[model samples]
Target: MRGTALGAGVLFAGGLGGGWALYTKLSDNITADDAAAAELARYERERPTALVRGAQNILVIGSDTRAGDGNRRYGKDSGTERSDTTILLHLAADRRSATAVSLPRDLMVHVPGCLQSDGHRGEPSFTLFNSAFEVGGSACTVRTVEKLTDIRVDHYVVVDFSGFKDMIDAIDGVQVCLKKPIDDKAAKLRLPAGRVTLDGEQALGYVRARKSLGDGSDTGRMDRQQRFLGALVSKVQSSDVLLNPAKLYPLLDAATSALTTDPELASLRGLYQLVRGVRAIPTEHVQFLTVPREPYVYDSNRDQLVAGRADALFSLLRADRPVTVTKKNTSPGDSASPAFHGNTAAEDSCT
Candidate 1:
């Protein structure tokens, strides 16, 4: 399913240039003077780095933008950006299993205090979770997550809107089973649904499809993407892409071109390590999770996620503990939750 799912992206404060050497982008108005630059230099040096061990957590993002050549052809976009998708991919210490956690963008959160690109003092604001990226980029988002989950974010990766299309096209296409017709004006999709393996454009629309999909809720959309990701991962591992050099060549090119990651993880070797670790997850043990959520009781109009449950989930990841997906409904979760699929043999065997 990894194939159909891509993490959502976008955040401007201090982003890297997809290079091995970390390149920071400063605000046009805020100049980094000598002292400020020196301090940042020292900070970079002291920034703790971790080695690949047992369980791990990596934040993956998919940028919602139409600024690239392929994206611009699709439609005009607003100047601002938002995370089209967000997923926390976790691998156990032994690398025998894996899990991908999806965080609801609209879930109201206490955005931790941080410095913005404009040198403005940012206080803890009650805003949508995605706002962390908008106000302070990946750094602030990481800070906010640390504050909320207390889980150390090892590294981050980003994928652009156009690049995702390129990836789908590069892989030829992905199979999808659609039972109903789709004609979503918002997603710019029009297709009579069935069991169809979609191409680049159609697949993109399929994953981003909101209005014409299910209930048009972000939660529903996440479910669709997660399922697709599962299918994608299955395809990659099952197909002879690696064994057949010809098939693997296009795949590698697309992956490198479409991905942007922290400097230390921008190389082919780094990617190979990551994919190897993940592939070790026996086909049965891979899983997906959504932050437990409930309707916004305080606002009634939005969502107020179940904070304690989410905290517990992250704690499990931080400790590299095997996640016990609660399947027998004791909660008010919908059928969309993949975790509720019962604790079968596949639940406990992974790393």
Candidate 2:
């Protein structure tokens, strides 16, 4: 009997040791963006102040960097990268609501002078929004966003193509209902109409496919991306991925392996603190919308923010106030009662 008890104790200790090793491995997968933090600190006095005490604003950037191993298949090594997708994610101070506002890559904005790779400061110019990333990477993109919205970015996360695909696969694919068939050779995606579950590769192609979907406008593409993300959030929250340790480990490994984040969110503990608030928020409170924008007057291909409309939305976010959204379009004249065209996680459905 004494031998049996001793053996059980030894086995338990071994199990705990193995768990710690796995934890360390997963935590170490995150790449800390210390250089970006140092760059931002250089202009600390000029950056926006935190408006709300506990509210957090994280800039999530999808990097189109083709230099990495798994990324080269997308295209030739361009020697530079761009912010393929940028979303300013706002978490309410009370931690009851969350909003994700997608910024159009083609939106024309003032790209502030940022430090370039050549070690020379590039002159500030009004150009496409994504150019900020191509010029200076994550630091420049965060600075540009702060200047444009006057919202303090608490942190930033840059996820590459391979990481995005791996994360989707870790979740075992996400389900979406298509209204029509799609075949885009450029995006390397071909899918039939109706309900379907997309693997990582197919999911990437679906979100990035512009020409073959909608009216071939970036605006329409943004809307589609928002819906897909909402679906993803719902999937993660509703599934056993979070509750079951077996299913959760793969997700953490995949997510951490693909992330390059600010120093504040570089560890497992920091990410857990952030995710704690996110997971508790009811899915119905999770909202997704694009900033108010229209085609540029000079160039129809480019986009420009709609006057009054965009500022009003930004003001609500800056003050950490609730942002109301709906599928119905609101009156352009009534900025006082602003309800932007958007959908909530609860509203996303195949029907």
Most lDDT-accurate candidate: 2
Number of backbone collisions per candidate:
19, 0
The lDDT, on a scale of 0 to 1, for candidate 2 is: 0.82
In model 2, the runs with Cα more than 4 Å from the true position are: 1-17, 328-333
- Error (Å) of candidate 1 at residue 247 is 2.7
* Top of the candidates by TM-score: 2
For model 1, residues 1-351, the per-residue Cα lDDT tens digits are: 332111101111113255222112111111212332332234354343334455577788777767767777655776546677888877788877777788778878788665566878588898888887777666666656656666666667777777777666766776666677777777777777666677778878878776567987887788777767765676566545444445444555565576666654555444445555455566567777677778888775467767666666766677777775554355534433323322222332112
User: lDDT for each of the candidates?
Assistant: 0.61, 0.82
Q: Alpha-carbon error at 331 in model 1, in Å? A: 7.4
Compute each candidate's TM-score over C-alphas.
0.77, 0.93
